[model samples]
Target chain A: MVKLKGAISGLGKMGLSHAAIVGAHPEVDIVSVCDTSTLVLDAFKRFTKVKTYTDYQKMIDNESLDFVVIATPTRIHYEMVRYALEKGIHTFCEKPFSLTIREGEDLVTLANQKKLVNQVGYHNHFIGTFRDLKRLLDTDVLGDLVHFTGEAYGPVVIKEKSGTWRSDPKEGGGCLFDYASHVINLIQEIIGRPTKANGSQLKRIYSKEVDDAVYSILTLESGLSGVLSVNWSDETYRKMSTSLTILGKKGKIICNASEMKIYLKEANSKENLGKGWTIKYITDFAIPVNFYLRGEEYSAQIANFVDCIIRKSQTEINSFKQALITDKVIELLIADSKN
Target chain B: MKMDKVLFGDNQFFAVNHLSDEKSREQAIRFKDDAAIIRVLDQAREIGISTFMCTTHDRIANVCDYVRANPEKYRGFKIYPCMPYAHKYANAVTDLGIIGTIKQYIPGNIFSTFTKGGVAFIRKDFIGFMELFIDAEMKMFKGINTPVIFIQNVLVDLILGLKMFDVFKEYDSYIRKKYNAEPGYITMNLPALLDSLNSIGIENPIICSSINKIGFRMSGGINIYEKYLTEKTFRPIALQVLAAGALRPKEAIEYIGKFPKIESVLFGASSKSHIQETKELIEQYL
Candidate 1:
């Protein structure tokens, strides 16, 4: 059992989280790290023996790596991931894969051509309740999905404040990317890709540039319709909250990160679901992992990346193709908001 | 150590619900003003629960100001200020950029340390910067009785994952020497954190974690936690004991009450009846 060598390119919040997750893997050794923050890199240099670099190319060119987790800003994900793919290293880019659809598609094509084990960091796909929902949707628990309402809200940008990358639309800031990408990706995978979005609204409550909230009505490829509602300016929530509610002729299902609630008109014998309502905890469906962090889903996503790289195979869960669809949906929603 | 049998927490005032979002909003609406928060704190104090374990939110700063102003009225009240409110730094970093965040959050004395800093600062900046932030977070709780200072689970679990066991030692020494308070750790993974702290030779560590019947957010599961509770010597505090309102109060209290080694049980509620009932239950069961 040979170990794989890994490197991480960013040292932002998500980057540091991935470093902790990737650094703890039993089958991997973190050989190098790259970030613009001297303070963060200094901490890493002082704490661990991983080689630190200010330049992304210097880290990639200097180290012999098996994979790289690119957790940089959304504006630079294209260049960072493309360089990693071209270097023949497995790449795991963070969520909202790229700033634009063209950049996402180009990276997708390049990763495919290079035959790399590419994945994106949409950790929601690895959540226990969501995984169960995907499986249950394939079953008859919800007969012929009629509609859905996807929502995410957090107190991210409440007060009128100066701008960061989050408030800058060109830098991939906004509710659509920072907050709602998770919901859009979940809607794409669990339900169907939103083919058309209309009457969309990107409201700016605080920020000068990017939207603080996003809302729209969506029609899926299968012609199933739904509504998307997300807000980051709501000060009521303690943290980011994302949930999904789907309706069918037979019953309905509502789910979030912690638990799931389902209602049925009649019992489904094969799935062991009874009539009326059933409440299921995430622990029942959560898959155990070697390492634990903020949540099981985070470590599970990183472990999936390492496993896919070890097997030299691409992952369907949080894969680059799946993320490209999310990028596409973001563009559609933004275009609709203008109308 | 004058540990209270039943402690009142401030999670509800800050809209921190472990499971449900709707409940958090309800609490936010209920505790909308500083007067509302002080009202609950005063209620809990009158109900004989004196200690308030809360985060260093801006609103908590206002609460601290009120309590400091009216000392004789609210006599013998204590607060356990949790350092490094992650959201404070997160929102500051977003608005002010990295360097501005440092200048804004770190006390003026930190720059003096930086000016005197040499290669030693480079080597020890990670832990040293943490102390600086600790100093900043402590500004709001001045002239208040804080018996225990806690590091939130976000940093504790991050350290556990990084396997940076040495950071705990630095924090332990700093909190004890500078603040004259016992250092406490709050984590989701109690077993792993206990292992890390024990390996660092911090004996009889105080840990706050989820101990529930349904194992909601209990990282290593209920069995491992039970093994530690009955077998281990560390001081334990149970939170989310009701499993985010999932378990019946009697069943939850009775299950935890079976473990006599649990030193304290922390709960947050808005109503006086709920607090009185819970405090009674703790006395009755434990």
Candidate 2:
């Protein structure tokens, strides 16, 4: 079996998790890791034989890696991704791809030109419940889409604190990038991309710099309009929760990470769904993965990336081009907020 | 894992109802006070449940303190403390650096382990990290009777998927030697975990997993679980037997009762009637 030489930059929470996941991949060997934090790098240096470097450029230049997972903050994403694409390495970058839409657009073009496998970490698309929802939508169960709403809430910023990268707006730390981007991306993929966003308000309850909450009404490319509401200072939720509710002429569908509830006017024999209400939990339909982590979606996304690399294919459930679409939506939301 | 025939759980007290978000919110509101938790535990105790399999959440610190403060009233009561409550560690590592967090938890021997720095550190202190993490997770249950300590499913499944099966042996032996207690594992994937633990020579281990009629959260499907219950030699504790309220208590317990190999049933309920009803159903069935 051939092994892909992999290197990871940024050793934050997501970075460390990716390191562990790819390190455990049978078809990959983590040859090197780069992180500015010695506290984090010390573990790799002491525990494993994997070389550690402080400089991302040094790690890439020294290793001659087959692939790199870029988990660094948003400020440096463009340069790192461009360099990796220039080196012709398949890249797996984290979500909220870049701080600017132009940077995201440039990367999309670069990745496409380089003909490298590129996937952003939008793990929600890989979730069984959401994927099942997408499948059901494709069947036209929800007839003509009437209206929809995408929501996400969490307790990320319950207090006024700073100094971490999350507190820095330049680092893409806020409810907008950290939370709403997920909901927007999920909404864009599962439904359609929002063409225009207005009536937007970026509220700050705890954080001083970035908005702690985002509220907006969006019009999709299909002319279907919906609301995007997200807040990270919500203490009621233990962790991040994202939900989507779509209403149509025939039925209605409501989905979250754990379950999906579908309501129909009558029974659909073909779909095995009964009349009125059909509820399905995530466990009932989730596919098994060889490696499991926080959720199967995390591993599935990575596995998809690795499989894409092995196949020498570029199209993905979440390619850089698709993510840039979401980045455009985010930029419009922020632009509409300022007005 | 020797425990009561019916083990009371702490999920309700901690607002961890797995299925219904509304129910968890109600539970969070209902059990907001520590007294509410003590009241519910007393209700379970009145029903003669001597064991409480609970995650070592921050609130459990108060529960353990109460259990420790009351010696005579809670005689023969044991807690199955699940370790490294992921939320606490996730919050703590941000508040305190890695070494600071470890030192805050295990104040005694952290520096000694850190002092050994290099290949020798890798050879010995890596195990020391596991042992110390266990020690840190176990610090809350001091002086309380804990016959079995469980590693939370998150870490267990992570290690299992990583094929680091030796962590099981290290955790098993550490729990046995350091705490004089057996180590239990809680996982969503029972079959694969059983194979992994078996390969690591941890035979006939006690595992807690969901074993409902419809196989909610039962990884590898229900057929393999049935095979394990009928043929495999291990102590199986049935949890989420109600399928997160998808099935009736009577039907759930009866379905679980068919497996004579299931050693115990663990459940959580906020009300006295619900608790008593589950206990009776388990007795009538398992």
Candidate 3:
């Protein structure tokens, strides 16, 4: 198969990171970059040693690119994805597929009609431990799962000093849009979409007109409950962390990302196991596993996209249908918060 | 003349709840000397309603010290301290040792010196620099002539808990429906804060307001006090409570005219000029 060429738009931190990684990959080439800010573009250009442009359309017009990674603010997602897909280039975009489900649906339809590869950035779920846990659930290794819970928290933002895009609701702003997608995507990938979605979104405590925090719950189609909690106002000022605890008929699994601890207990067991488990008096045993990913999901995603292009296979790496469901879940959560 | 008791409270809008703040108690204690509080408290007295005092573990001393300094102004009115710590620390089911603390500090009492470092008997046990307020209130109301009003500090803690706003809303609705006709003083929670109050035996109680963090400026420096007030359902309740305890005398009269339910308002003061302005607002409203 021929190697693919990739370009990154919005040479911000995420853009620069993606560019550096793409430049280093053997099967992919970081051919070009784009951003409205010349200073950002120039800095990213020097760091990645790649050509840069101020406009994305111009980059698409000039470069012979295999794919464009849309790392711009969420508001630009629809336009950027559409422009790239229109040119028959596979596109990789950030989460919050777009601000609304309608836009997400449009992107999905376009990706399907043109037979192009579309991947949304939900790499956190690509962690080796999560992959192992998904496998365990698939094989009923944990018994009938009853509940899936996620808790994520971080320091509150009192000022716009961190960045300006977050404070503006129009730029895919607010905690729900900015952060909750990771939780939503993880849960959807594990238990499937919720039969019902309802929960709260906190816009502010002292600050006005912007969401500073959010807490939500989603009930899945399998009668298993999923709770997604996120707070930006924790006074302790900790970094972002999300942990998932899955309760099964015989045991429970606790996976805390921030602490890097995973504890498993089979019901009515005398022994507590960490990595491997063997029990006699219990109906089931819980096992804990962990590993690292060198952008395997992103690389696998791109490789899968390329394969779909060459062999005309169906594209299914966190596909548009799944992302659209995530969009709808976000919409419902925001609505719950407002009421 | 009939006396009316009106309670006004702010929706604690800070991202961090009061309990979550490492300095919440200390911060509240330091603000005890803030001249604005005395002015507001004095203004409430001038309006002819009983002066109501709010309690925080960190700031209870400030209110206690002010009342001690001005015995004459606060003669007939009693200081109703909402004992928050007891409820916070002691659980009958989980910790039986805390019951003694509750037995000592009751809500109603006039403290000669409300100091954070004072001592009181929690049942037979003597502990702390601050009084255990729950025990004191039970004593104050044993057979008192004036009816004793017990406002649950739970809702206040809930506000300080800084959970989801919807939790506040759910509790607000439940409290109002259950306690609307029940007698005695209860702090008015949000339109939704009443639920938790009802769950704990108090129903549909009146809520109070204290405008603290709501006065902050927004992105363009717009004073969002009005917007915050409207969004939290305080406007209608303010109309109901304008005439009661601890408010400017003239403001009380005008507020009473606007809403007949208001008989008194609770005011906090910090300086002579602030007190004088409150008096003027009251006089003008009158």
**Highest lDDT scorer:** 1
Candidates in order, TM-scores: namely: 0.90, 0.87, 0.48
Worst 10-residue lDDT window for candidate 1 chain A reads A283-292
lDDT string for model 1 (A160-188, tens) is 87766777888898888988899999999
Q: What tens digits encode model 3's per-residue C-alpha lDDT throughout A1-339?
A: 467888888755456545544553446767788988664553344333567798789999899998888888889999999999999998878777888778888999999899887878776554444555565567664677877787665554534333356556778766677667777777788656765666665656433445767776778877777777866544343234555677777566654321122334542242334433431110011111110012234434444554565566666557767877888888887777767
Model 3 CAPRI rating: incorrect
lDDT of candidate 2 over A199-314, digit per residue (tens): 99999887878888999999999999999999988879776788999999999999987889999998889999998999888767666665556777877788899998898887
Better of 1 and 2 by lDDT: 1
Best by TM-score: 1
lDDT, candidates in the order shown? 0.85, 0.84, 0.51
Candidate 2 lDDT tens digits, B165-283:
77688889989999998889998778888988998799889899889998777766688889988999888999889988789899899999999989899899988999999999998
Instruction: In model 3, state the lDDT of residue A230.
Output: 67
- Which lDDT value does model 2 have at A7? 90
Report the error of model 3 at residue A95, Å.
1.1
Q: What shift in Å separates residue A80 of candidate 2 from its native position after superposition?
A: 2.7
* Residue pairs in candidate 1 whose N, alpha carbon or C atoms collide under 3 angstroms: none
TM-score of 1: 0.90
Name the DockQ score for candidate 1: 0.35
> Among these predicted structures, which one has the highest DockQ?
1
